[model samples]
Target: MQPTPLATSPMPDSEMLRLRQEFVDASWWLTLVYALISSALLPARAWLLGSWRLSDSIIFLFIAGYLLAFGQRRRLGGWWRDSPPVLVMMLGGSTGLLGNGLLGSGLMTLIFANTLVAVLFGRRVVWIAFLYTMGVVLLAAWLYASGRLPPRVSSDYSSSPLAWLMAISSGTLMSFLVLHFVSLYRQRVEALHERLRVQSEEIARLAHHDELTGLPSLRLARDRLRMACHQAERQRSKAALLFIDLDGFKRINDSAGHEAGDEVLRVVAARMVEAVRSVDTVARLGGDEFIVILSGVPDARTATEVAQKIVAAAAAPIPWQGCTLQIGASIGIALYPEHSDTPEDLLRRADSAMYSVKRGGKNGYALHEEPRTPGHTCQPC
Candidate 1:
């Protein structure tokens, strides 16, 4: 059977949708984590500072936002679907801006957010996120320079246990994000490589096998013939080449149609394989023609016996479409070191012998007889 071509297009819509849903679910988990972290920080800050600063209200707002986003995550659609990367990046950037500005965890948070976007979305979305981040940093820098915003003293929180806790928590989450996506990317690459390796093997198989009968093609047959001859030479034994032609195949093709003829050929090929020894090579030489290489044969007589089995196999009726299709095999065998030691000579002489059988009425086997003079002749077996 002919192999179906491998797909080279993007994933199907169902798969794409499923992947998007997974990302959506992951986003919800991220939101829930952020809310929990913020909630924990609120209590830690109240205990450390002895009183809640007014800026603590901003933390409350952020915590509420995270919780609300997490709750409504399943309902994310329309605008949420189209621009989740933008929404997520902005949320992360906002947290960094209000918590410590870009000088603190804000810068790191923004970078991680961009990386997250890069993983889920394409490069285009990542580029847009980068531009947005740069714009925010520049605006914040300008405001601080112009005295429009109060100067954030890094030393104010740098030595605080609360600041350290926040840093450790955020860093751990960001690192997990980086590692998770990195592992996913690696798995996808490995899967792709495996698919390519399998496809390469399939392409090689199709190249050297018959599409119709799934038997070895002429190229593979020739390679086997050469190896058989070489092995026979080393072992000081005999090898034989059998050339087979299906009798009345043209008549079947013309009368019943090519489909029926193909079925017949497939059946014949299977029968021929069953008739030969497991070590022997049975190959198709295209359209109603096949070749068998019998390795390490004792004599021409052994080759003849194998050919006789093949003839009996082919002579059996093949059932197709509620009708019995009758066919026969005309076999010609030539031995190595006796007829000719070379694969080329053995194939040529066997083919000549097969034609001799066809000319002398088909459905029989012949042994190649080398011409003593100019003309060639085949000795019927």
Candidate 2:
């Protein structure tokens, strides 16, 4: 599923840290490469160009900055949210400033475009553009006043030196004002986006995971199982659904506070995940109950093996709150079609068998079979 804007925002905290470390390690190597090439190349170009202007060097720096930022883009996100938008504004500003020195015409136009990009992008893309626009307009205007503007040629009376300078100078001043206004608008938009991003992340985390166990909740589990079942069916094979219930969960919760009970659940959830096949699915259906879906199981034997593995894993006493605590689970095994056809039906059969095991004797698994009732929970006819 396509993630919301916030979900796709900057890299996750863990990934961000890893990339930061990698960037630090790799940065020096890239610098050394650039240094080696520039030591040999930049001097030659500067000598041949006969003393390059600051703007000329600025262009090269802008390109290098873009490359550095772009290298991290894939890790961050490619669309809508990567890179500081302000930096882009600054980049455009630099381009226009450099253009003024090299191309010498339409410097005002370049600065204006920088403002446009800045105003358009907001926080993730703000101030950099604004700074460049301001720099070009004020500096260029000052330079023009000092006779830095190119002299106008008069073939027609319409072309006058005073008029040409005034018009270009006025245009630069006007664009700077426009850029200033754009900056304010962008700031407001950035604030709104930040608010939305926070809310989006909060909602996504709550929806996909259990509050107590920190495992995928039933809604998310259903989606995963649906996909796994589809794959198993395509291969004309089978999958196992194990309904897991902690044997004495209620007594532990009632005796030791809910906090201690929660820890047990967390411990059990972790073990369940560790016990299963890598292709299996583990989900919490709330309050001391869990489910495991094992894919590509060939028959009841395979399903039985998985259920036994989980029971073994759960039987290991979990270390919690600096004390070892005992836990046992009753599991129900239900194979696809052998138990029932649909996801819900399979889950119900597995659940029934789990209850049977829980009642007959705790800490064991019962293979699901048709209940002795017509249309009972839609068990196989």
Candidate 3:
């Protein structure tokens, strides 16, 4: 049979929502920067030439639209987030056709815009942006060669092959740097997520277990008992609750300090675990007090035998600090359906019986006996 798989906890909804908002904010700022830069440069270039070209007017219109979209960003969706780079590419292509085909600065902007698309989006978007840019460049080149597009007017650098080479090389270098940093940022985020996942698992484990003895804590033990009761009721089988208290734990703590007391507790916990079956649960209720849940118990005899084993195991001398230290356990056993049906009631009865053993004398075991009255509950002895 295949082993049962552990349940995986999902990322919290609040965390995912926060990340989405952060991305939206990042995209908003990026668009804002691009708009501010374009609004400043386009008007200046038109003024310098003493006339506004159709390409410059179109770019201004695109910038206005982008600003409007940003103003209502919360109302807009993914389209608003992706529109800036797409608009830049279109503006670059138009400017290239109006100026000097592949020789103009518009080609440089197109390259940069494509690089931004790759940085912000996925591989598919990168490919789409790349193909669009290439198509625009080729189409402008064709229009110029065929005498359909206007010749170079704003600048004479278009005639120089060295100028074209420098523009392409610089654009390529800038895009490479942008893409490299984006990759590094993604890797860092992934590493942080992995660390958080591991820490979450550890926090969950620590919450359910005792730090000192490495046993299930009282709350976890109570939950286990409740589950055991449900299972017994369903299967029509007996379950046992063993409440154990260390006889001289307080004296040990007082005489040997808390460190030695902790050591003794760890040793006793290990011994109690060894004395129980694989199906049984051994838990530390608190400070030297432990509980065991025995499932599928055949009869009271089995519980009694297990209680005797635990008492012996716990009473054995522990070797510590080059000397032998001794402690005793008083165990109380309560059977499901015989003493009480509920997990709470069973545990209470077992606790009462354990006190009876302590009162009678240390280092012994007791089975809880039901009260004579129909409604009266057994009190602690």
TM-score of each: 0.71, 0.51, 0.60
Query: How does model 1 score by TM-score?
Result: 0.71
CA lDDT of each prediction against the hidden true structure: 0.75, 0.63, 0.73
Q: Candidate 2: lDDT of 180?
A: 47
Per TM-score, the best of the predicted structures is 1
- Please give, for residues 94-192, the per-residue lDDT of candidate 3 as tens digits: 575457565556676676667567655778888888888788878887888899876645565565544455455445544555555556567656866
Residue 176: error of model 2 in Å? 3.8
Question: What's the CA RMSD for each of the models?
Answer: 5.9, 15.2, 11.6
Question: Which segments of candidate 3 are over 4 A away from where they belong?
Answer: 1-164, 370-381
Q: Could you tell which candidate, 1 or 2, scores higher by lDDT?
A: 1
Give one digit per residue, the lDDT tens place, for model 2 in 1-381: 112243444435544344433433333233334323333443454564456656547646755765565556546543333333334334434444443442333354455445445434456545655565667667766765687664232233135443344335435444545654545446545655686688787779779987666678899988877776887889988878889998777877787767668778878888888888777889999887899988888888887777777787777887767877777888888888666788888889899888877666578677886322111232322
Judged by lDDT against the true structure, how good is candidate 2?
Answer: 0.63
Please list the residue runs of candidate 2 whose C-alpha ends up more than 4 Å from where it truly belongs after superposition: 1-177, 187-198, 370-381
When sorted by TM-score, best at the front, the candidate numbers are: 1, 3, 2
Which 10-residue window of candidate 3 scores lowest in summed lDDT?
370-379
**Clashing pairs counted in every model:** 0, 9, 0
Superposed Cα deviation of residue 160, candidate 1 (Å): 7.7
